[model samples]
Target: MTRRTSTSIGFVAVLLWALLALFTVGTAPVPPFLLNALTFALGGALGVSWVTATGGWHKLHAVPLRVYLFGTIGLFGYHALYFSALRLAPPAEASLIAYLWPLLIVLFSGLLPGERLGPLHILGACIAFSGAALIVAPGPDGFTGGIGLILAGLCALTWSGYSVLSRRLGAIPTESVAVFCLATAVLSLPAHLIFETTYWPAAPAGWLAIVGLGLGPVGLAFYVWDIGMKNGDIQLLGASSYAAPLFSTLILIVAGLADPRPSLLLAAALIAGGAGLAALGSARAQRRLIK
Candidate 1:
């Protein structure tokens, strides 16, 4: 496949990542541990079943063991921290702060071999981040939500590592990477069983939400992202992925879970404008390099 095509596909796939991320993380702290555990487990089962029926089950086992382990740990860390952040801060704050990931990617991109940023990447990063701060900092409080913002910062930074690692996965099947992540959950389950002191749910309604989460966000979403990344450009992946957060923010407002903050609208504009311009600018730069 051409570099351009891969980049475009990855951009679309990863952009949806924000919406699922907000769901998993925003709901994390408030939902009982049982809720997420069940949700993820059900999703995992459903995902595996779908894959198996399609004879794509081997995709799960196709990745290198180390890649799987890192992904698992990295993903787990994001979930745990993100949920905890929700408990500590507002969803907007948490979501906006987490959006700082592009910046994280920019910084970390330098450390990874063959992933160095061009000057345009820096300009795009600035535009993207300015938009993030606007969304997150809505209201005169100037970054209210205090410690929660800090926690979200940490969460974004952690996921940044995962994103960086993903770009480095040359020729590795996305499915293999996913299988490794699922295996990580299994590997970590024993530890969770041993140390997690949360109460168990005895009802089916609560159980449904739990399962929905894992399958929709963690399982299906990750799989989609993996496939996109394997065949796409890193810059495209980064540029277009903000759609997830934008979608989530809109959902929260529609659900009445979040009051529509005027600042949020402003943030949305910045994020959308910034990300769009950045993507376009990157395309232009790539063209210049070609010329």
Candidate 2:
């Protein structure tokens, strides 16, 4: 199959895995600190081991320490913010808002020396923002649509910066960068102890939750996203990523963390619907080029 088809499939797989991760998080009574640290540590060990087994780890030490610092510290903030938003906001709303990452990337692309936004890029920004608004329209009880909007906006900004910086790293080995992200995220481990708890449930069920996160969402999901995103169209990347939110919210419904509230469901439809349009546009353009 073509790269785009493969990527669409990969994106869907990642979303399903992410949904499982969300359910794990929802069910676990663990504090966020302990949960997030163990979460990254498990994923980090797996990623590092996977790369090392195949000699890919050798490329890592050659990378400047700065790369690790940037990858670790920068990504820590992004993931932290992303997760916090889910804790504080509705799943679907958080996903819709977080997706502004691609639009931010396009905007940053325009500001960067050689990066520039085109008509399609501008179109994407507008569509995505509208979807976000629909998803997070203000509510009360501090679950204010406003709060969700803010948190989601933060995730998008941080992730967008991560994307731009990663692109700037040029042809750096993808696996090496992944190592830096997972390995160095350890810097945030201390925060688990200082700012929050460091231990998870001493139960089989808790361990299982950690495993799903580390292996699936944390380790495997990143690999899929990196492979799909780096090798596929950016707009298609944005559109395809909508799958993650939809799948995640669905999982939340099954877990009862979120009601199948009409607003949340409709908002999800907007994001998914917009994604379909963009994906269709990209496909038609590709077919025309081949023709």
Candidate 3:
């Protein structure tokens, strides 16, 4: 696919992730690791079905074992670290730190072989991060530097590193994300068993939400994201990822889970402006390449 097409597909993952908060809310009472296990299981199943239908199982065979290990670690390590961070730190602070992945991705992409980190990209990422901060910033609870904060920082690094490294593995088929999801599910099961009390979805909506999480955010998001990271405008994708939290907050407001606030309006403007700036930067780069 063209770079533009791949980037658009990658942005679709952000849109899907916007629904993550809503679905997680719907999945009330399900602990984090257990939720991870369930959603990833379904995500893996979705990938398995697609691979079988397309006779793509052979494609997976060519993939190296190390790649599998890397993918599994990336997928599972992110959630494990994030959940652990939240447990030790304030939720708002933890989330804010974890959300740094987008900014980190933009910064790290500069280190990649062909990628250039334009000023606009960095500026846009900072502005977008400020917008996200407005939403997830701590309230009366002040910051405390400890293992929790360190873990949260690592959470950001893990995801950003995973995304940036995926670009180097461009030849790796997106289908391998299926194995990543499956392996993540397997790993999550043991983590949940060890750290969490088992609890299934109590109602049908909860179950449906679990399925939605699997099919959308946890499932197809990873695949399209792989395509984008591998061949699309990585800088633009990183900068634009800030929109997931913005859209997610909007979804929560519309669902009556959150009240509309003045800060949300300002945050919306900031995020939109940042994303637009990044898009301009990406377009300029593309034009330069074509010339």
Candidate 4:
């Protein structure tokens, strides 16, 4: 696919992720690891079905074992750190810290071979981060330093690293994400058994939310993201990722789960402006390549 097409596909992941908080809230009382196992199992099943229908089973065999390990670690490690961070630290602060992956993705992409990081990309990422901060930053309960904060930072690093490194593995088929999801599910089941109390979703809405998470955010999102990171405009994707938190908050407000705030308007403007700048930078780079 063309770079533009792949980037658009990648942005779909960002849009899907916006619903993460909403769906997660619906899966209430189901502890994190248990939720992870359930959702990932569904996600893996979704991928397996797609692979079977497409007759792409041969591609899966070609992927190296190390790649599977890498993918599994990326998916499992990120959630493990993120869940632990939230449990130990205040949710707001931990979320803000963990959300640094987008900014880090932009920064880390600069080091990748054949990728150019223009000033606009850096500026846009920073501005977008500020917008995300407005949404996820601490409330009346201010920052308190702890190991959770440290884990949150690592959470950001782990995800950003996973995303950027995926670009180097462009030869790997997107279908390989199926294995990643399944392995994550397997790993999470044991973790849940060890550390979390087993609780099923009490209501149909909760079960629906888990299914939604598996099919959209955790399933198709990862597949498209792999294609995008491998072939699309990484810088633009990185900058645009800030919209996840912005759109997520809007979803909560629309669902009557959160009170509408004036800050959201300003945050929206900043994120839009930043994404615009990043797009302009990508356009410039493309034009340069054409010349």
Candidates in order, TM-scores: namely 0.80, 0.81, 0.87, 0.87
lDDT per residue for candidate 1 within 72-94, as digits (tens), equals 77766776666666666777657
lDDT of prediction 4:
0.81
Task: Name the regions of candidate 2 deviating beyond 4 angstroms.
Answer: 1-13, 102-124, 140-149, 197-199, 202-204, 284-291
Backbone clash pairs for candidate 4 read none
RMSD of each: 3.6, 3.5, 3.0, 2.8
Candidate that scores best on lDDT: 4
lDDT of 4 at 137: 57
Question: For model 2, what is the error of residue 44's alpha carbon versus the real structure, in angstroms, after optimal superposition?
Answer: 1.4
Kindly list the per-residue Cα lDDT of model 2 for residues 1-291, writing each as its tens digit: 466664665565446454643644553556555555666777677777778788896676678777777767655776666666666665656766776665565556566543344555556556666767766554654346556458768878887787666656645665764665565456666776688644556678667777677666655666555555455555456555656666667776787767797777776666656555655655565566579
For residue 41, give model 1's deviation from the true position in Å: 2.3
Residue 26 C-alpha lDDT in model 2: 50
lDDT of 3 by residue, 1-291 (tens): 998899999999989977866786677667778888898999999999988899999899999999999999998888767656755654434545566677778788889887787878767777866775665555455445357767877988999999999888999998999999999999999889998887777899999998999999889999899999998889888878877656776777788865566765676667656766776676788789899
The parts of candidate 1 lying over 4 Å away from their true place are: 1-5, 8-12, 25-36, 54-63, 110-116, 134-143, 187-208, 289-291
Runs of candidate 4 with Cα error greater than 4 angstroms are 83-97, 132-141, 144-153, 263-272
| Candidate 4 lDDT over residue span 1-291, tens digit each | 898899999999989977776786677768889888988999999999999999999998889999999999999898778766756664444555676687788788889888878988878877876775675555566545378778878988999999999888999999999999999999999999999888888999999998998999888999888888999989878877877756776677788765566765566667666766776786788789899
